[model samples]
Target: MENIAGTKSSLSWAVHISVAALVLIWLFPTVGLFVSSFRTADQIATSGWWKAAFPSEQNLTLRTDPPSTQVQKGGQWVIEGNLFGDKRGATISVYGTSSREISTYKAGETGKFRNGATITVQPNGDYVASSDTKWKGGRGPRVFVTAVTPPEFTLRNYQMVLFDPANREGMARAFFNTLTVTIPATVIPILVAAFAAYALAWMDFPGRALLVAAVVGLLVVPLQLALIPLLSLHNDIGIGKGYLGVWLAHTGFGLPLAIYLLRNYMVGLPRDIIENARVDGATEFQIFTKIILPLSFPALASFAIFQFLWTWNDLLVALVFLIDSTGETTVMTKQIVELLGTRGGNWEILATSAFVSIAVPLMVFFAMQKYLVRGLLAGSVK
Candidate 1:
């Protein structure tokens, strides 16, 4: 007994360690995406998400110029223009003539030039200079700055990706489109397969083994092999490229697996209880409705979660059966793919999209996980 217990403990430890390693590996990119999603496009392009945790040194541009047509006052060049305009409280830590290398100067220090000109900059975009000199023909001198940015995060990216309609169609509508496809696609197969599974498992039937065999056979068939044929069929059946077509496609593809899974779970149900329902003069439908369904809740919930998540995150079927070139029929996955192509450098948008896509699946799993733990699987195994 002690030996068995020790072996069990070792096996459990190995499983736990393996799970931990898998979890970390899985989460690393997700965490990186999440961090990157909050970052600016430039910031994401230049540095990894880890660097965002600390202040980063970057070369940025700063400029000072006279207002358009500034009038001389008291024989002085009363030039005026906004330096670092609309930056929303950016402090000037440094400035330079060329963009290549920028350096900071003390607020009270003077920048002496080769032309006997002096430049002094204040913290508040104010500047003073004394020079017996004139700026070069029709252009002002260029400046560069190396500034330390504090940890600045913004919801603007999320708003832009999810809510801004005039700017673009955005992921919000595609998120809803995904639901439109996913909910029905997930539900139809399960609904149809539940009755089929119940019939095969508990009801007297003709060719039951053959039906099960067919479903199992489909498990090995690659979906890609059928995509073109399915699309041609859709074009023929008058459904064309739309919600109805994709829903039907998903339902067909999902049904075999659904029926197979539900049949295994339904077969494991207690025969005595089903027989007792028969003794109670219940029809097959009634037994299925009242006894089998209530008893098969765990398997149903588990399959629902699985199907819902798959259909929610699916892209290939959407590409083939649904009209995705235009933004109208795009799903979250499709929209995300487009965003990756056009705005790959935008980390925050990517993260926000990722989170939005999975939010519903996460909710369904959390809410239904209880069924897996404490429901019909208990009765089935025993």
Candidate 2:
């Protein structure tokens, strides 16, 4: 009864719940990164991305007008100005004249300074400081305010991360460099593997079984073990440490899985189609080009997504093979690593850079994701 045809499973709701949880787990960080990328440094530092839509309270250290701006008025030296300067609409809840007691006085309350000077701050960040004698300091008094500010979002983080001319650590160059590495790395392997996979799946060869076994075995080989040897071989062949070397490395590493996936998919295609084409005077090449390639698109796209993501996010291979003293060949992963060292505290910049790096991969995945499960399940059924 439980296995009756077309009947619903008892645990279908559980499966749905599990899938929803997984989606949320993956979605939260990506959404957070997207939201954080548009936020200002102060906003990101003080609050989480989940709070981006609402007003936030922050303790800010601001300065009043300097003594130079003070004027003699009503037998006292007075300094009057807005703490936020041109920025408006923030309401200060509590104010303080010293760091130790940052929230000593509520907004609109007057407090006396050390030298008998009285300062009053309004909720709107306007302040008036008056001293009976003369103000002596070159600098203004430091006032700390706990203010509730409206949500702020900005494009300046993207400006600095991508388009700023003076930003030495900008991602524009690294972005193009990653694309240079990833596009060729992905395309070359698919091109080479498609041919090999077609031969293995459709064409009878003397060592076909051995070749398939070899590709399967190569899948288990650790990439780290081959890096130094492959690098040495590349150097010996005079293709050392550049785009060519990295491209070849990625292609070599990617081909086994590509061939395995594509071969499985190509093998499962209706044999009648290939037999009829062959019996009708079509060559193996003709059958492959016309019939097989079109049907194998899902598999090709699946491998493309995997290979594109791997090569795009690759850092160790780039570091080993794309050596450049001037950072001309640096990829986004390497650039982000450099940012961790140089601008570690700038969370907004880091968030913007991280989101920018993943943007293309996300687009690629979503664009071809329908094929992913279809391709992966190709030979498993038949």
lDDT of 1 by residue, 1-382 (tens): 5476456664777888999999999989777867776778766766677888776756566655643434455655444444555563445566655444456465435665455555676554455654443444444444555555555667777788788987573688888889899889988898899999998887767898998888788866889998999888988988888999999999998887778778888999989998988898998889888888888877787677777878888999998999645658988888888878987756667777877787777787688777545433532322
What is residue 229's positional error in candidate 2, in angstroms? 0.6
Question: Best candidate per TM-score, number?
Answer: 2
- What TM-score does each of the candidates earn? 0.80, 0.88
- Top lDDT prediction, candidate number: 2
Question: After aligning candidate 1 to the native by TM-score, how far in Å is the CA of 224 from where it should be?
Answer: 1.3
Q: Can you give the lDDT of residue 222 in candidate 1?
A: 81
RMSD of 1: 4.9
Shift of residue 170 alpha carbon in model 1, Å: 1.8
TM-score of 2: 0.88
lDDT of each residue in 1-382, candidate 2, tens digit only: 6488766768889989999999999899889989999999999999988999999999999999889999999899999999999989889999989888889999999977766799999999999999998888788989999999998889999988899989888999999999999899999999999999999998997999999989888977889998889889998999978999999999999999899999998888999999999999998889888999999888998888888888988889999999578778889999898888988988898999998999998887788878766656752423
Task: Look at candidate 2 and give me any clashing residue pairs.
Answer: none
